[model samples]
Target: MHPSIPGTTPDTSSTTARSHPKHLKRFIIGSVAVLSITGLVAGGAFAVQSAADSRERVAATRALTDSTGLQRDQLGAYAGIAEAHTDKTASSTLAEANQVLASTEGKADASALTAVSSSLASFESMPIDLVVELTIETQTETAALSAAAAEADRVAAEAAAEAAAAAEAARQATLATTNTPAGAKAFAQSLASSNYGWGSDQFSCLNQLWQKESNWNYQAYNSSGATGIPQALPGSKMASAGNDWATNAATQVTWGLGYIKESRYGTPCAAWAHSQANNWY
Candidate 1:
């Protein structure tokens, strides 16, 4: 209550004080709204970033799965070749790779996938060298076997030729002793027994038959065109036994025995009986 100055008569201190509180309340509400909007925007950005990270992880897992499948297929093909060659080292590596692939199946862990991929890379080239070596070895073994077979065949052919020459010389030596008439008779007896399966009893019949035909003489010839020890229809007919049929008693005897056995007589005794009955057998 002092004397009024020029234009200061009102005392509105209480009103100013009340208005200050209202302004404070409005400022508080606006600040709260601004903070709420900022929180929503921040949350939305974080959620979008999180979703993007999840998509990247899914793509990485898919890529890893594809890579692992391709690696497994290549390893399986190599393993088949290794097994065919009976290579134990390559087989072991393939087994280890399969185990690693099995452990990482359907997994999305990046570290596990990386480990498996690394293992596969390390194992990939291991079987290649072994396969190449095995292929070379197989080819070499095949060549050696072929060479050995050819050599064996050559040796067998040489041995067969030598045996044939030895057999021919022995036959020539035996025929040289049959030039005389007594030796020719003895050779005929031996030939009838060994070649015709005829014993002494059948030999008696064969001897009588040939003696009547040619006097057991390989040089005998008939005016009717029969010749040789057994009186073959033609002298050259005994050439079936040897080229020296006219002179070799063994040759003529061999042909005579075969003729008696083959001409439906079956034995020299049977031929003798037929000759006695028909006079032409």
Candidate 2:
């Protein structure tokens, strides 16, 4: 109203100035409340994040501890297996190998054992496989030696049997010549018939001839150094027939017959005729 402009109103300057102070105070209080609420929310968020991080750390530590325990258990299992292997080898194979070695000839006798003591004393230090191989080789050698010994014995037995048979043959060969005069004639008669295709007449002639000389005594000897039933001159000459020619009548008779045949007196009758004429044949 006091000189107002065309479209302007009058100002309440004093009233506005009085209300502005109250408004500015309220605004300042509200801003402080909002800032306190915001601070409380941020603090709660930080606490929750910290708790989650701590739980994550705890889970990671547990996982690492479990992994370490599993690794330790595996190592223990490997160690136990190695220990079992050592025990088994020591108890069974090693013991058996030692026992076998102890039974060997080189270790059996006290005197023989000393020769191999150095090796045997430290034999356990050798590897188990090597010990086992050596044991097998030794056993095989022992078996071979036993077989050789047995074979030698068998051969010796066979030779002894052959020698015995030869001796028996020599004894039987002289059986007829060792008989008494009457028995000699009977045996000669049988031999003449079977071997010489002669009859009793040839044996009778031979008996008479030998009776005049030695009476068929296998051990007959003469002052002229003659020996045996055939009275071979130079008694040692009968050795050509047999080493026992002096005692073996058949050996002497066989030699005498061979001599007669070579001298063209092929039969006992022929030898007797020649002997009768010359008193010796």
Candidate 3:
């Protein structure tokens, strides 16, 4: 049982009631589209962030690998030097670095890789410094050994030179004691008897022959360029007997006796007879 109102339409109530479901449906659809777009945007941002992180990780890992390779090469070089020099400290340091590098293998995180790379770089310097120290020590020892060897050689040379000088001095002292005129004549007499089988008569003739020529003086020099007890025409001729011909009476007597024995006379007595006739013999 309804009653009529004024002229405000009853159709308005029905139309308004019907439009609410349409408006509500449109609002629901618009809200669903906005939520879908927001989700897509959020998902895209997450994917972009994930890809960037992967690139960073890859870059870091590559850097770590390259650095590790360089470190390994350096480590190998240092190990060789250490082994050659027998440096225990440097070898130990390299071993520790090797363990650290081994620990970093297969790591993939960016932060972890960068950290390990830094640690490795720092570790490399320690072994290098140790190797340098070892090299310096080895060089120092080598130089010291060389210096000691040179000193030893110098001392040995001086000792040898001193010994030679002492021997020469002893020879000169002996010559001074036994090279007088009387000593020269006695030596000649003994040599003539023993070597030439000449008797006292031969020695007496040899003595007279030499006395006339140079008076048995070992240092005798003649104006005819003759010298020594033998009075050879050239003083250098006496070098056949001994290097000390100018000063040694025994050398001069030996040469003179040989000349008398081997000459055309072949005997001291014959040589004396010839000298007595001529001024020179």
Candidate 4:
């Protein structure tokens, strides 16, 4: 109005100021969008980290649980053996038993660890539990032999024991005998220490057969055609004990025991019956 211009008007300054308001609004929108994207990215990273931590915790828990289970099983077995002491504390057998307890306390596979638990002193203890069980049922049968021993007859005891030993030797001599290796007898004893259920019937039957088979000889062997302690018809079968099945009692015992467990369910009487029926154990 003061100086009327053809192209410009008094309202031009107002329009320019309004344009600044729109630009300010656009800037605010862009800042908000950037902030939203940043927040989303941070939240996603946090979620991933939390998930990884949770998985790690889960794995740790599983490992702890497995270790605890093995420890408990081994502990219970050791406790059972510790409760049943029949000999002097200083006996080598007792020492080996203690060693077995100590060895089994650590983490390891059960079967492989069987060889690390015992010593030669514990070999006789292997059949102690088994003998106890058998004596209960078949004590009458051994009564003549026991009576013979008690009558000032170390001769009878020796003869009977020798006979039993001979039978074992015979059996072992024929088949793939115990394949555990001589050094492993102690280890087997450790496992035997845990075997609270081993019985006399098993002992008697085993004695009767194995004495005739291997004469208590761990390394005794029959001809290749004859095969291990129980003398399986085919020598090849004793390989279940080890590749050197023909020479090892551990391998033989493992396989023979498996057969008894599977076919006879560890009943020595059943094994005896089968032996009687088949003429081959």
lDDT of each: 0.59, 0.53, 0.60, 0.45
Each prediction's TM-score versus the true structure: 0.40, 0.43, 0.48, 0.30
* lDDT, candidate 3, 32-120, per-residue tens: 11111101222123212233333443454345447556343353354455444544543454444344335533332233323433443
C-alpha lDDT of residue 120 in model 2: 33
| Sequence-dependent TM-score of model 4 | 0.30
- Ranked by TM-score, the better of candidates 1 and 4 is 1
Root-mean-square deviation of every model: 26.8, 33.1, 27.4, 33.4
lDDT order of candidates, top first: 3, 1, 2, 4
User: What 10-residue stretch in candidate 4 is worst by lDDT?
Assistant: 30-39
Candidate 2 backbone collisions, by pair:
174-250
Error of 2 at 3 (Å): 99
Which model scores highest in TM-score?
3
**What does candidate 4's lDDT look like per residue over 1-281, in tens digits?**
23433332222122222223322221111111101110122212321223333344345434543755634235334434532432232243334444444544432223322333223234334433332333332323233333433453565677899999999889666443334333333333333334425555455665665556655455565666666655665767877667866666666666665666667445555667766888655
Error of 3 at 105 (Å): 54
Residue 248, model 4: lDDT of: 64
Error of 1 at 279 (Å): 11
Q: Pick the candidate with the highest lDDT.
A: 3
Q: Candidate 2 residues 65-150, lDDT tens each?
A: 37555343353354445435543544453344445445543323233223233333343454434443444444444444445546
Candidate 3 accuracy as lDDT? 0.60
